[model samples]
Target chain A: MSVKIEVGAGGIPHNRILIYGLVGSLVLIYLTYLNTYFQTEYFAFFGGLAAVAALIWGTDTIKHLCSYGLGTGVPSAGMIALGSGVIAALFGATTGIFAPIVTIVIAAIIGAVAGIMANHVVRMDIPVMIVSLIELAIVGAMTVLGLAAMACGTFEFLGMITGTVSFLGFTVQTYETSVIGGSIIAVIFMLGAIAIQHSFNACLGPGEQQDRTLMLAAECGFLSMIPVAIISFAFIGTYAALVALVISIVGWFYTYRKYIVLSKRDAYAWLDAKPILEPKGGA
Target chain B: MEEIVFGIGITALAGALATVAGAAEDTESDIGSQGDPNSQVQLAPQMGYIHRIFNKAVAGEPPAYGLWVALGAGLAWAFMAMQINPILAIVLGSALAVFVQGVYATTAYLGRTASLAKFGQPVYIDILKSMTTVTMAHAFVAIFTTVAMCHLIISALGHPFPLPLLGLVWGIALGAAGSATGNPFYGKERQYQEQKFGAGVPISASGNIVRYAEAGQRNSLDNGFFSAKLGGPASGICFGLIVFFELWRTVVFEELNIWGPIVVGVVVILIFAIIDRYIEVWARKNFGPYTAPEEASS
Candidate 1:
C-alpha cells in the first residue's frame, strides 16, 4: 500500500501563501532601486529582507516537490536552482535598474528547461516538477541578487567586478574589489544555496508543520545575510554596513524565537538537557 | 577562425574532464553510502540490522563538492597569482582538498556511528580503517579533474569569472548530474535488489533494506562495485553532455551576437525536451506500473 502526506495539510492554502511571498519579495527586492535615486547605501538591508522572502517561498516549493517521492531532489533542486540562477544573475546584474526583472525572466527560462529535462529525461515524474522548479529558480536568483546587493551595496557589473575611477570620459586607474576579484560571489553562492535548502531538510519529518519551517527559513535567511553584511564593509562605509548587520541580527532573533515556540507546540515532548541521556530502568 | 578552433578544443577537453569528475563523484558517494538512500542505512540500526556501512553525509553531494572544488580552485588561484606553475598549483590544491575530504569522512562516520551506539551498532574499525583512504583516493580524482576543467575554462577560454566561482558552478553541476542520473541505480537496484525490477519501492518497504551480503554482511564497499558498472558511467555521460553543449553553443554562436548563444540554448533545450518526452512514454508503455497485491492474487 502507498500513502501520501501533505506538508501543510490543514493550514492556509499553499498557493495563497506563495502569492504572499512572491509579491512581498518582488517588492522588497526593488528597494535596491531606491539606492539609485538617493545615491546612498542606507537601504541595502532591504536586499536581505528580499532574500528572506524568497527563502520562505523556496521552502514551500521544496516541500511541495519532495512530497512526490523525491526524497533526494530537495538538495539537488536547490543546487540546480543556484547553479542556473548564477548564470542568469551574472547576465542580469549587468543591466542597470532592470537587473531584478531580467534575472527573473532568464532564470525562469533556464529552470523550465531543467524541469523538462528532469521529468522527461531523468524521469522524475512529479506533477508539479516544472512549476516548482520555475519557482525555486526564481527564488534562487532573488537570493543571489539580494545577497550580492547586500555585500556590495550595488549590483552594477562594474561596481561588483572592479574599483575604478572615471573622469568624464577618461579612465583614471583601476583596482581590485572584493565581490568578484576576491571571490566573494562564491561565498554568496554557497550561502544562498545552503540557507534555502537547509531549512526544509532540518525540519522535515512525519510531524513537520508549515509555520515552524517557514520561521526557520526566515531565520536562516537573515543569518546568511549577516556574513554578506559584514563583507559589505569592504565595499560600503562602516556606518552603512552596520545598519545592514543590525537589521539582520534583529530579524534573525525574532524569527528564531518564533521557530522555537512553534517547535515546542509541535513536539510531543521537549527536553532541554546537558547530555540528554541517562540510566534507564533496566540499566 | 583560429579562436573558434581553440574554443572548440577547450570545450571538448572540459567535457572530458567533467566526465571523469562525474564518474569519480558517484563512485565516491556510493563507497560512502551517502545521498537519499543513506536514510536506509540510518534506519538499519534501528530495525535490528547493523552492518558495516560508511555513513559519511556531512552534506549533499552538490554543496559538498562545491566546497571541495572551490577550496581547491581558490588555493590554486592563490598559488597561480604567486607565479607558481599552473599545473603544479592545481595538483597541490587538489591534494589539500583531499585532506579536507578525508577528515570530514572520518568525522562523519565516527559521529554517526557513535550516536547509533544505543541501537547495538558496533563501530566497525576494520571497515573504517580501510574505507577512509579509499574514499579519499576517489575524492582526489574528482576534485583534481573538476579544478582542471575550471582552469581550462578560465585560462584557455578566457571566461570572465574567476577560478573559484567557476569551480563552484561546475562542481554543483557535476553533483547534480550524479544525483539525478546515477543515484537511482545505487538507491533502487543495488540497495533493494531483492525487490521486483521496475516496481518502485513501496511505502511498506521503507527502511527495510537488504543487510546481509552474499558471503557475510553487506557494506558500502560492496555497493561501490555494483554502482561503478552503470551509475558512474551514466553520470559521466550526463555531466559531459551538459558541459559540452553549454560550451559548444557559446563558442559557435557568440561572435554573431550576445543573443546568439541564448537562441542556441533555447533550441538545445527544446531538442532535449522532445527527446525526454519520447523516453518517458517509451518507458511507461514498456514497463507499466507495479502490479498491485490484489491484482497479483486475482
Candidate 2:
C-alpha cells in the first residue's frame, strides 16, 4: 500500500500495448498501402522507433507505479492509449516534424491527471475504455490524413497538392484538387469520436477527484492536438519544430491551469495532492 | 572493442541487478517513507506542491535530450574517428568529449550553430548546472544522428558504402551506451523542478513523489544536477571512434560480415567499463580525500 507511484506517464499494459501496436501497425500499414498504391518505397524507421521509445517511456513511467484496484487499469490504459493516439496522429501528419508541440502539451495535461489519478480514480474503466477507443479513431483519422497527404503530398485543406517523389520513394499521385480527402478524414474522426468517448466512460467508473484530474488532463491532451493540427500548417523552416513544441507547451500549461482550478473548486479538495498509495483513499 | 562491450554489458547488467537487489533488500519493516528511511510517516506535509507543472516540464525535456545525447555521442565518436591518434588519446579524449562533455558540446554547438541553439541555454541542462543538460545531450544526438543518417541514406541509395558514414552510426550508438551507463536514473517532475529551475520557479519539490502531491510549499532549494555525475562520455566517444575505424579497416581493406557493428559494439562496451573504473577512481580520489582527513581527525 505504501509503494510509490511513478509518472513519466505511460502505463496500462494491456490496452496501451494494444493501442501502441495498433497505431504503429496502422501507420505502417497505411504507409505501406499508400506506397504500394502509388508505387513508392520509403521507410520511416526512425519515426516508428522514436514513437515506440516515447510511448514506452510514457507507459513505464506512468503505469509501473500504479497500485491494484477493481478497474483502475481503465484510466491507466486509457491515458496511455490517448497519448499513443496523439503521438500517432502527430506522426501521421504530413508535417509530422511539428507534431511534438502537440504531443508535449497533451502529454503534460495527461501527465497531471495521470499523476492525480495515480492517487485517486480507483475503479477507472469508463475514461480508460473511452480513451482507448479514441486512440483507434485518432489513428484512423491520422491514417486518412496521411493517405490524403500521401495521395497529394499536401496537408488537409491546404491549397496546393503536390506529388510524391514518384520513382524515388513512397509514391502518392497527389496533384492539385485533392481537397476531398482531408474532409473525409475530418468527417470520419467526428463520427468516430463519439463512439470512442462512450467506451472511455464505460471503462471508467465512479467520481473521484483524481478521476476528474486524470480525465481533465486527458481531455486537455486531445484539445492540445487540435491546435497542433491547426498550427502545423504554418510550421515552416527552422521554426517548425519549435512552433510545434510551443503549442504542446501551451497545451500542457492549459491543462495545468484547468486542473488546478478544478481541484480548487472541488469540495473534497486535497490541496495536498500526494499519491494515495493505499489504493482506496487516493482521489 | 570486445572489451568495451563487455564493460558496458557488465556494468549495465550489474547496475541493473544491483538496483533490483537493493530494492529487494528493502523490507516493509526495515525503512520509513524516506522521512528517515527507518520510520513510517504520513504523506509528510513537507513535500513540494508547485509539483506538477515543473514535473511535467522536466519530464517532457528528457526524451528529446536523451535521444540527442545518444545520437550526439555516436556522431562525435564517428567524427573524431576521422583523426587517427593514440589509441588511449582517441578513446579517452573522445569518450570524455562526447559522452560526458557531449551535453556541453551540444550546448556549445546549438548555441553557436542552430537558431534553436540560441534557446539552448534556457532549456538545455547546463554542463555546469542548468536544467537542460539532458536537452543538450539530446541535441548532440540529433546532430550525430543526422550525420549517420546521411550515410544510411547513401547506403540505401547503394553507391559505395561511404566509409565515413559508419563512424557516425557507431559513434552515436556507442555514445548512447556510454551516457546510459554513466547516469541511469530516470527523473520525475519534482526532481525536474528542483534540479532544473534552481530558484527560478516558485514550485515546491517533494522529497519523494511516490504519493501525496503538493505544490508551492518551498522547502529547501536543491538545484544539484549531478546525482552521481562523472565524465565517461570521453571514453564512450573514443570507443565509438575506435570501433568505427576498426570496422572501416574491414570495410575498406577486407570484406567482413556483420562484424563491423559487432566489433564496434564490443569496443564501445569495454571503453565504458574502463571509463567507469577510471571515473570511480577519480571520484574516490577527489571526494573521498576530504572524508579521509575528516575520519583521521575523528
Candidate 3:
C-alpha cells in the first residue's frame, strides 16, 4: 500500500561555495594551523572537534555498519574513516616522525574501533556535526594552553610538552614529506581494515570485492606518491599536486557513479533474469 | 549506567511478559494450542500488543546496551573504507529503520501460491542492502563519546557521573533507556508478535516472519488502516519522548555531565521492568485474556 512508503526530508542542497570565500577560509585555517602557538594550541582542539563529530554520528551509523533493520545513521562510515584518518594524521604528525606515525596509526585503529560504535548514536546528521563543533571548542581551549607552553618552552608538562616539541622538530620539508607520505600509509592500513569489520554480511561473505577495492586504492596512492618522494620532484609546486588531487577525486566520482549507480542490484536483477512472457497485444 | 541497564531489563521484561501471556493462554483458541493446519491465530489483537511493545523496544534498544560502553561515533570513521556516504552511493540506505517491515513483508511475497519464486536468493540478498546509517563525523563523535565515557567510568570506577564520564555513562544510560524501557521498539518485534499471535502457534505459518505482511486492516482505526495494522510507531514515539526528556533536561539545565541523576536511568529501568512484569500479571489475570489474540484470546 502507498501508506507503507514515506518520504523523509533528505534533499538538503550543497551550496556551491564562492571561490573567494572557499579560498579565504582555507587561507585562514592554514595560517592558523601553521602558526607555532596556534598549531600547538589548536591542533588538539580541532582534533577534539573531529572526535566529537565522529562520536555522535557514529551512534546511528554503526547500526548500518553492523546489521540491518535498525536504521543506519548519516555521513556514512566511509566518509567518517577518511575524515578521522586525515585529521588524526594531520595532528599527530605535528610532534615527530614517531608522533605522526603513531598518531595516524592510532587514529586508524580508533577509526576501525569506532566502527563498532557507529550504530550507537542515531540522530545521524546535525547532532553528530554539532558534537564535532563542540569538541572543536574544547580542543581549542587545550590548544591555547599548548601555545603558551610553546612560547615559554620551560614549562614542561610530562611528555606532552616534549611531544609538542618533537612535533615541531620536523623541518618544513620533512613536515610535507611525512604529512604526505604518512597519510598515504594510513590510507593503506585503512584499506586492510575491511577484513576486520564487524558487519555480519561482510563477515559472512567472501569480501573479495572489498579486498580488491582496497588493493586498487592502495596502488593509486602508491602511484600518486612516487612523484612526491623524489627530491627533485619536491619542486613541482603545490598547485600541481592540488590539480592532480582534484582530477583524481573527479575521476573517482565518475567511477563511483558507474559502479554504484548504473550497476545497482535492482538494475542488474532487471537485466539478468529472463523476460516475463509478454501477453499478446489484447490478451 | 543504571538507566541503560534498567531500560533493557524493562524491555526484555516486556518481551518476557509478551511471551508469558502467550504461554499462559489456553491453547485451543491460539494457533499453538490448535496445532492444526486449518486454524490460524486471529491477527488483530495480538498485533496491537506486538505493536505497542515493539515500538518501545526499538526506541529503547540503545539505552539498554549503555552499560556496555560500546560504540564509537564520528564522520571520519564511517568513510575509513569507502569515501562516499554508502547510502547515497547505494541508494538503498533509505530503507533503514523501516527495513524490518520491508524485509518482514518481502517474505510474504513468497506465500504459498508461488513457493520457489526465487525467494531464498533474495532472503540473503536483502541483508546486503545498505542504509545511509552513519557518516564520518558521526563515527568521530561516537568514538570520542564512547572512549571518553569508558575512560570516565573506568577512571573514576567508583562514583556515578563525573564530567569526564558523562558521554560514556549518560550516553549509554540514555541509549539503554531508549532501547530497553523507552519502548518495545528496539528488537522486540519478534517478542511482540510472539506474545500476541504466539498463543496459537501456526501449523506451518511462520510466526512473526509472515506476520510482517499479514499485519494490517482487520479493523479501521484513527491512525490509518495500518495504525491498527502497524504498531512499531509507538517505539519511535517512546524514543522521541525519551530523547525529548533527556535533551530538554540537559540542554536547558546543563545537567549533561552531572552524574547523580544517571542512577535514575538504572533505577527507573529496574522499576519499569518490575512494573512491566506486574502489568503482564495483571493483564493475564485481571484483564481476562486482554493480551491474547481472539481465537487464542482467552
The interface RMSD values of the models, given in order, are 9.7, 19.0, 15.2
**For residues A6-50, could you state the per-residue lDDT of candidate 2 as single tens digits?**
222232445555456445534443442332345432321212222
Clash-forming residue pairs, model 1? none
lDDT of 3 by residue, B84-134 (tens): 442232122112212222221221111110111121111112211211111
Listed in order, the DockQ scores are 0.07, 0.05, 0.03
User: What order do you get sorting by TM-score, best first?
Assistant: 1, 2, 3
Best by DockQ: 1
TM-score of 3: 0.33
Best by lDDT: 1
| CAPRI verdict (incorrect, acceptable, medium, high) for model 2 | incorrect
Judging by DockQ, tell me the better candidate of 2 and 3: 2
Each candidate's fnat? 0.08, 0.00, 0.00
lDDT of 1 at A169: 69
Error in Å for residue A29 of model 2: 17
Candidate numbers, best lDDT first, in rank order:
1, 2, 3
Tell me the docking grade of candidate 3.
Answer: incorrect
lDDT of 3 by residue, A1-283 (tens): 0011111122221122122222332232233233245333222122212222222222213322322322222113333544454445345545542432344345645554453344255432332343332222222222222221221121122222221112345423332122122122222222112111212111111111222222222222222222112211122233433443343345434433333322132121322222222123411
TM-score of each: 0.58, 0.34, 0.33
TM-score of chain A of each: 0.89, 0.29, 0.28
The DockQ score of candidate 1 comes to 0.07
